[model samples]
Target: MNGGDGPSSYARNSAYQRGAIEAAGALLREEIHKRLDLANHTRSSFTIADFGCSSGPNTLLAIDIIIQALLHKFSSSTADVKTPEFQVFLNDLSHSDFNALFALLPPQSQRPYFVAGVPGSFYGNLFPKASLNLAHSSCALNWLSDLPPELTDTTSPAHNRGRIFYTGASAEVAQAYSCQFKKDIKSFLVARSRELAEDGLMALIVPGVPDGFLDSQASTGSEFDLVGSCCWAII
Candidate 1:
């Protein structure tokens, strides 16, 4: 979901998404140009969806970059239309504070893009089929839909007694998290695939760990990892 802090808290921690969006400038520009060209520069409007847009100005940055890219592509064109209206959807979970998001929106006088809020989980299809020209999300995929059950199943071999996460646990623990993650991501991909237009582009920013890195290297492994590690060491 699009949530971090009530307002500023989320924005302050969104440096990752912000940096990812900026780094994707070339890719975004290329896709925008391609879509514009495909429409023969005659389409009257463009639609974009920012899935999992948690609160704050960070969402603003990403969408602004996308809108700017479109404008740039059409700037030198001979398209009959001056500038097509941009429709941006800011999506998050049902509980996301869309009010806070709207409060931060730039006035129409300062920007041409029209904005709307979409409330729901992005793990499923949230838009109409072939309705979007672009879909974007960043720094939010690391979250799994649910904790791996085996980790807390006292009777299960993979039980991670006394710990809250999989880090520093046995291979079985990591495998559980991995398996659930795969399932969640596959569902996500399937939903988005059906929603995107034939020419639509999706841009995503996912956090990374080095190849060969183990659960021990989880960048922000929960505090339970320390206790779990000590328990393992004592055993």
Candidate 2:
């Protein structure tokens, strides 16, 4: 699924969803503050960017929670400090409705100096190397461009019309899906690594199986396992 269609489709399909997305962002911001001591980094400015930031009520709601949490944390510190000026860059595909996102911004808040609608996939480089101090992505990375085509073959009795997991799929199809997923994930990590500063924090939340499963199958799963090992590799 493409970025525009993915979030819009999910927003339309889910009926019982509350403002849980925003709440999750708040929780993540709190975690990052505790981990990074953003308030103590007074000598230099800090920046953050959210990739695959789909435009809608949900996206802005999440950002608002994150910004508010950061502000609250920054305000509570007493140490002599050069208060870090924040640069929040909101990024999504070029086709996204950024006007709607801009209109939703709180009038009193300090707005982002750079508002960009980055075209193409976020699995590619989206920001400059060491440019970002904090990066956040949520519930978006799992949407691959399209399903792998190699798994589909008319002659094969197990083949099922471009799907990896049909009722009669062989082990090979499962392995192919796994391969595609790993490639996508590795691309994601490389792009993110270019954007993050040394000691920078990236809090990514995505739906997935356990990290141990990914680690155990390292030969077949090394690319996918990179997400869990980001801190170890970067730090």
Candidate 3:
């Protein structure tokens, strides 16, 4: 895990930073509520999954918040006539630590919920078709498996066209990296489409430049987009 060297290294190490992880979970909780409202399916069954959930205190913290938020919202009078049981899946690479997460469960909670761990890259399908009701991924997905090779070549004219924020590199290499990111994201979405149910909602928070300066095509490599597309395809 060389965090500074390239994409995989960064993905292995950066995905679990403390503050950013907590913030991401908080934002995801809010986004889940927002999406639920948007879908107008307030009282239906709810199942949530947190993708790329590396082992750590922050991951558990996020899960706690998400569960609490859902419990509060779904149990309210405005919700549907019957309370829905929640099945939460926690997903991450096989190497991720789960001992800590498993140890942190609260005792005897009112909300009827179950937790399962899914091992693999979030890039692939992790659930049954139309099984997930909500999905949240945070501080992840920016890490592509590899940097695009075209960016490494200094002679190409399109080099600079796809480059993102790394200014020290040749422009062509940057463009290649950008293109690779877009392609990767598209594939990610296609895979997620197989698992998300109709009207399912997902919230994703990733690192990016403010003011939308980051290339839209580059940033589009996202778990949120993939899950959303999956939901759309079902409809």
Candidate 4:
């Protein structure tokens, strides 16, 4: 992802991602209201982690939605409840533009939560065991932790000589990418499971090709392939 709020930056180009998160707002609120175990949560603070929270206003928007849903949950409850202070972990790759992300945050006086940046891949352990009350990730899980080793090994059948991505590549190349995705996703789930408190809710807005769907038919795949082609040309 491009850093900063420049014309080509992710912060500027991520309206589609923002729209997806916005469209899911109603369902997210409903799930939080129904499934969030507030009764047993005696903690003074509510911890929320956003995995793959790239530089931006989109991450902020997603956090606001989650916070609003939680507020509504407490407000509508028949039992009197004191709202807990929110602690949000904005996670992304180490090289992500943290400065740009922090710059976009609401001022200290207006902000509702204590924000912190957690820089690392979400495919591994990020938080301590059972620390988070809610874990949310939007339009980020599709990224594999790393490329499949076989894709670069000359002797491997999966060696992708002319392409950088699996789309439009050979079956072996595609399979390698698929396998890596599965492995990364499994690792992500395991790590999150360990970090989330019992009864914690996870909201994921992952975009991917459906089963039986052709990658060639997907705009995202096409876009990546095009980018890969450009990179290949440079090489």
Candidate 5:
């Protein structure tokens, strides 16, 4: 996520997706504003969580979209309202470059946000119940929180030997990946459900594979076919 500016450096290379991601976020702005309206929200403060927020400038586009939507709501309210202050949480794996992400953050004087990093797998709970007003994710959900355990167990009969993924593998291999994806997504949803406010809004963007490619039903695996081609490497 840091250091040299190359394909490996997410911060330096991720702008390729910024245009699309920001466009997607813009589409959600009106919807987010409506959600705030429906919630009858009048608070001058709010919290937002960005799950799997890898270190990059692209993440900020989505975060700001959500923040600006709420601010727009406050500005248009019939009653006098003060500008809202935002508390933003950027989440990713423990080894993620949180310092790099923080370094990119605007100074306190430039923005009305208090930013913090919450490092962990998104499949588990990261915040207290009802703590989040909005949750966002982009190009992250396609990855399982953990590798499909059955793929490594010989005795369990679901070993995914010789295949990186289940795309063209035996039915058992496909089933194993499917089952693992379902479990991961279920855990992720349950965790988020617990953490978000009742009226909270969530936005997620997933990159999808083309037709005929196999991936977790709950996920879109764009490079998944590569798994079948590179299957022998693992063996």
Candidate 6:
């Protein structure tokens, strides 16, 4: 994701992604309320980690929704409930504009949680085992940790020349991308599994394609294809 809040920056260009998060807000709240095990939440603070949190208002919005849902859950409980402090870890690549993200935070007097920036790849462990109560990510899982090896190997059958992505590439090139995606996703799941507390809840807003759909059938594919075309034209 691009850094900063300029017109072309990710923060400004992310309404499409924001809509996906907004659409999933209800489901996220309901699932958290119904399934989060408060019995195991005996600690003084409850931890929530937002993986791939780009510079935002979207990340802030998502966190606010989760906190509100938890607060409502506590208020509705029949037994006396002790609300714990909230700790939010906003994670993204190291180069993400943390300063801009912090600038978007609610004022210190009004903010409900102790928020911190976590910088690193999500494919590796970022926190201690069993530390997170809620793990959340939106519209971010599709990113591969690295490009497929063969995409850069001119001699390989899967080499992806004249294109920046596999959208209209050959089957072998597409297969290479597919294999890399699987590996990256598996690593993500494993790392998150290790970080989440027992009975912890995970909320993800992942984009997907129908079984028979081609890459160009999706909006993102079309956008990338356009970018690639422009790049080739300049070259």
Best candidate (score: TM-score): 6
Model 2 score (lDDT): 0.63
**Which ranking of candidates, highest TM-score first?**
6, 4, 1, 5, 2, 3
How many steric clashes between backbone atoms does each model show?
Answer: 3, 0, 10, 0, 0, 0
Model 1 Cα lDDT, one tens digit per residue, 1-235: 3444544477556676677777877787786676555444346778899988887777888888888887887676765566778889999888887887888887878988889999888888888887887888877777787888888899987887767677767888778888988998998889889887777788888876788876566756754566667877887
Model 5 score (lDDT): 0.77
- Between prediction 2 and prediction 6, the one with superior TM-score is 6
Give the Å error, residue 2, model 1.
9.6
TM-score of each: 0.83, 0.70, 0.67, 0.96, 0.83, 0.97
TM-score of 5: 0.83
Weakest ten-residue segment in model 6 by summed lDDT:
73-82
Q: Which of 1 and 4 is the better model by TM-score?
A: 4
Candidates arranged by lDDT, highest first: 4, 6, 1, 5, 3, 2
Give the local distance difference test score of model 4: 0.90
Deviation (Å) of 14 in candidate 1: 2.9
Off by over 4 Å in 5: 1-7, 15-20, 79-81, 155-157, 209-235
How do the residues 47-90 of candidate 3 rate in per-residue lDDT, one tens digit apiece? 78888776644556566677777766666646445557678888
Q: Which has the better TM-score: candidate 5, or candidate 6? A: 6
Error of 1 at 111 (Å): 1.5
C-alpha root-mean-square deviation, candidate 2? 10.0
Q: What is the Cα root-mean-square deviation between model 6 and the actual structure?
A: 1.1
* Candidate 2 deviant stretches above 4 angstroms: 1-23, 39-44, 108-114, 153-158, 162-168, 209-235
Clashing pairs in 2: none
Candidate 4 per-residue C-alpha lDDT over 1-235 given as tens digits, one digit per residue, 9 for 90 to 100: 9998889999889999999999999999899999887778788899999999999799899999999999888778776568889999999999999999999888889988999999999999999999999999999998888878899999999999867777777899989988888898999999999999997999999997778988788988888888987897888
Please give the lDDT score at residue 169 for candidate 1: 72
lDDT of 1: 0.78
Q: Model 4 clash pairs?
A: none
lDDT of 5 by residue, 56-108 (tens): 87778778777778778777767556666789999999998887778777888
TM-score-superior candidate, 1 or 5: 1
Show model 6 residue runs off by greater than 4 Å.
none
